[model samples]
Target: MFEKKVNIYNVFELRCKTTCYFGVGAIDKMRDISEYLSKRGMKKVIVVTDPVAYKVTGAWDVVTKYFNQFGIEYVLYDKVTPNPTVEQIDEATKLGKEFGAQVVFGIGGGSPIDTAKSVAVLLEYEGKTGAELYEGKFTPEKAKPIIAINTTHGTGTEVDRFAVASILEKEYKPAIAYDCIYPLFSIDDPQLMVTLPYKQTLYTTIDALNHITEASTTLARNPYSILLAKETVRLIATYLPQALSNPNDLNARYWLLYASAIAGISFDNGLLHFTHALEHPLSAVKPDLAHGLGLAMLLPAVVKEIYPFVAEILAEVYEPIVPGLEGKPGEAEKIAKGIEDWLFNMGITEKLESVGFNEGHVEKLTELAMTTPSLGLLLSVAPIKAEKEVIARIYRNSLKRM
Candidate 1:
């Protein structure tokens, strides 16, 4: 659907070197990792997770069984919460160090995996706190190896070098990107996702959709990244509804997981734009809000704000969702409206105000967005060059009741 001709002479660098195992029973590959670790003389591993969800889903039993059979000792650090905080990372890091862990295993959603990334780097730093990492004060030459088992199809933290942690005291969520933090390997098992609640399935799918959309349109877009983005968008548009409607559909679940990984790889190369920059502050301030929900609430407004500059690419993004709209007049508006209608159908019809993001919070959110380090990256890669005023207006627009 993306029919535009790209410049063949453009130079780009891509570095997705993580070995990924993707399928219905990918978790079984833990034996391979166990053997790899045994060869390295690494005996202790720290598993970072959300305890309740892991236990409820039986992923804990499955993972531990594999490790136990391999004679690998592990310490469970299950304090990771949604929108993980600097404090959580610090606590996990302390536990990891105390356990004398040689490897870190992240076994949940983005929050746990991100916490593990910080822990992996902090394990080598000795005295460094997560606050120092959040502030970008220290860069590590090497990090303890990380094994990321993705239980959700969102936030490709499994394959990405980027880790997002919220500093609640500062009311800021800064994304830390370092090469050393990339997972040594990752497993994508759709069996792990069949038990996911429909709401979570919906939200995580939307998050993956945003990743594909943003990655394809950013200034960093290369032919390889765009190829991944287009396929990711197509997969999500086709299979997400099936996964939500029939949670037991393994095929749908498998594709969604694949989409999440490819989108992660795509965005890692192409980067993201204004939607992520805007949503981070919302989650940072609220702490309880899910990242995908914030993106769903804000994406329509962001699409509208940047439409004039990215009409062609936006239309291309929407083609997967609404066929035959790529070359039409007013295609961008059609794309935005299609997304809004899809969200409504998915029961994500609430606005920012429904999530406690009212006009009163606008000024504070705007200030945080303006100050966020990712704002510059977003603006630089955005199809449109947005200023502080434009960012503020987009926030205000998102606050209106749907």
Candidate 2:
């Protein structure tokens, strides 16, 4: 146990890149959004969104009203799907290019926002393809302006500089983080999130939870990450269940959205490690898997491995859900079990096997984790050295119910 009296004696850098408008009426900022773009001579826009969430949330109606009032021209690419692909980004980029789009608006959760970020970057470089961009063949210096109109309680994509897209052919889900992809403006209106279905509400919030859990303990973590991660956990722990029970609880939705945005900022500053690093392979191998559910499945196994290295910090933050966790070396197993139980109680009861993965798939998952473009960097920053054996073991451990 290393819980000592804490003191702030070190200095670290923090980055808060996006100008975010959050609250009940935050979407009304669309008027200011139009002005922001008009002021910058960005009239034509490409909107990236899923087919359903944007329309049902009424975000599209509100945004288009402002666009029409401001005399802004826009094209909608509403075909973005979950686990957006390189092909999808390229498709959207082509549409943007053809439409002479000057601004990109991502109008859903991670999938759309991430696709928008990728599209924004691809639009800047005339001939660049999503394959080349994800392959790390080019480092983009700048991108067309991106505006994030986030409509989910998860995916701090609105506030972060990272984007994920899959190369379905190769089963690779590589993430790109460029300062240029940071959204110029963001809206986090919880009103837009009230209609989020039960499973989505659960999965998305879990995604936010996983972000901070890994960010706080990664090698890149500092006081800023820890501080924000703690608050993120507190808010999620306090509010997620209420939103789960009553899908229309605006107060619960508000705090959860706030937690998600800050969680994005936490990871933006602290970076992420095991859970995210490993989950990408799971979702890449099985594109139907929601990223958060994959991460939820892997979290306990990852915590078991990482707890010893940062026991006091893990115990401090995780205490809200798993009370009585102690900062001790041998307690990793207990912490992992406690967390598994917590997740089960939260209705995340599916195991890897239940989701169609078996022992045979572990080898492929392990290979992908080690060889994926940016994943090795995540592994290097993990609290534990995630060797091939360690990665395989985590996957195997997650294949069964606790």
Candidate 3:
């Protein structure tokens, strides 16, 4: 087993900078944003979103109606796509600048919210392109205020200071984790989530589960983060299936939203490990792959690889995820198996091969993973140190169906 002595004098700090308003009718809080913008003398605002889904689901109407009633001048930039690209961020930034937008509102899942974060920052740094931001060549001292309204229960981009942008030219997906990118405020309304498709609900909830699992087992795990992670795991393990079975179950939807937020806060503070490091490259190679699906395919194998080094902590996490499994023999393996079974039951039984990831693609994926800037941070926090070959092996293992 891997072990290290703790230095008692070491110092750490925790800060979740966004103020969150969460509930069923939480969308009503847009009135608060109107007042907030009015106080700041902000007239023009921009709303970033995925045009089709948000429009069909009526989330767009809810936002625009509030802006109109408040007499807030707003422009809609609804070109955001899944795993948003740098070109898309630059395009949205151009629109925000043309409209003289002062505040940004992101009303969807992670892609729109992340695009909004990148746009908000780029707006502050005049003449800087999204590519420059992704390349670390330009850093903004400030970002326009963002109000993140989450319609999905994943990617806690609503509360976190991180935003991921893909650069296809470079074939890389880099996460920008500047403090300035944190949304000024976040709204989590379960009512908006009721419209989410069953597949999305399942995938997003699993994404939240992976966030908690990876965060809890990382080197950065602290008491505060661990408490949040444990509660998040327990809630998702119990409530996710209930919400899936009956999409109209408001209570289950509310808890899933709460768990998603908690998992976001946990991972925001505790960081992540190999699961994310390995998963990012897959999506970078194939932008069409949903992040949660890639995570579902890789997490069990990654956990199994690291189980020997972090068995005790995995056992602790297992108690909440699988009741009555704590302190049992082979608890680490049992926890990993439980997660695999959960993903299988959720209909995410396909391997990387199902997504066109074959053994032939392993080299390219490994190259991308090795070059990712976040990989260094992830590996540092990982329970076991992994070499490039080890990472490649994990990718190969993910190709095998459970």
Candidate 4:
């Protein structure tokens, strides 16, 4: 552990311009709120969501009914995929244009919300298709305002201006961007989340935990973000399972839900460290694995990669979650071991191989990981750049969990 006083560079970047209103009962209060949209000068809106959202929360119906009753025309493009691609963004964006969508009301989990963010930027800058936008020179031209409605309690992706989508050239390779990173509105309604499947409930919790881990432990050192990162994990350790087992524990759901929004804020503050960077390639190659699954698989390994600079802080913050993890001999090692051991009890399959990756696939997964936008995340932590070889090793490590 490189231990004297540590110095971390605080590069402050705040990307979310969209105001978020969070509450357990916000949706109910939001009825007949077309005046708000009218004040924003929005004539029409586009909703990016999946079918499950329709069944789980009646969010789709509520939005449709409200807008219809208010005479605000809107269209729905429910074709967004779990790991959305350039095609989906285009389809939704096109639909938005067809309907003269002035506002994009993205519903559901990260997927639809993220798709809406991408489409808003694409439609605003009509000069490029999803693929074209990813070309050598990518810049957002014109984008309509976006209203994000979160249904899942994880990956605050909807909380920021970032949109992570797969490109055509590299099918699973991630293409993340900060251009046109502004949302007009973002909403977190927990009622919509009460119906998320149990597996997803756990999956998304891990995802939120990873956001904090990376932000606090990654290569970049920002003092302000470290606590935000730590708090994200702490809240999860305290609340995720309560929500998982009880399902309707409003207090548990609300706290974990708060953790999600705060973690989103932390990740958006610019330091989205290595776990995300590492998970990107794993997911591109194995789309069967949920984003949260890939993240859960990679996080413990990534914690091992955490720089000794912040090891003590990381371990102390994480101790409560890993039984007997605090002040142990080789605390960092113990922490990582605790994570693996705990995950095993939870019945989560961390190995990519268990999730269907072969030993032979490592090279490509690592190759693509090196190019992910957040790859710099690796450089900041462990003071290791995860150059091609290192990235390949991380991929292999994740492929067959240790």
Q: What is the C-alpha lDDT of each candidate?
A: 0.83, 0.89, 0.81, 0.69
Residue by residue across 284-310, what tens digits does model 1's lDDT show? 999989899999988888877776676
lDDT of 4 at 211: 77
Better of 3 and 4 by TM-score: 3
Candidate 4 colliding pairs, count:
5
Model 1 C-alpha lDDT versus the unseen true structure: 0.83
In model 4, the runs with Cα more than 4 Å from the true position are: 1-16, 323-330, 372-383
Report clashes for each candidate as comma-separated counts.
Answer: 0, 0, 0, 5
TM-score winner, 2 or 4: 2
Tens-digit lDDT track of model 4 for 16-72: 566665666556434435667876577587878886785568676677666766678
Q: Model 1 off-target regions past 4 Å? A: 1-15, 326-330
Ranked by TM-score from best down, the candidates are 2, 1, 3, 4
Candidate 1 lands at a TM-score of 0.93
Misplaced by over 4 Å in model 3 are: 1-15, 323-332
- True-vs-predicted CA distance for residue 361, candidate 2, Å: 1.0
Question: Model 3, range 182-270, lDDT digits (tens) per residue?
Answer: 89888887778788889899888888888887888899988777788778877787788889899878778877887898888888898
**Candidate 2 deviant stretches above 4 angstroms:** 1-15
- Evaluate model 2: give its TM-score: 0.96
lDDT of 2 by residue, 23-102 (tens): 77788889998987887788999999999989999999999999998889999999999999999999999999999999
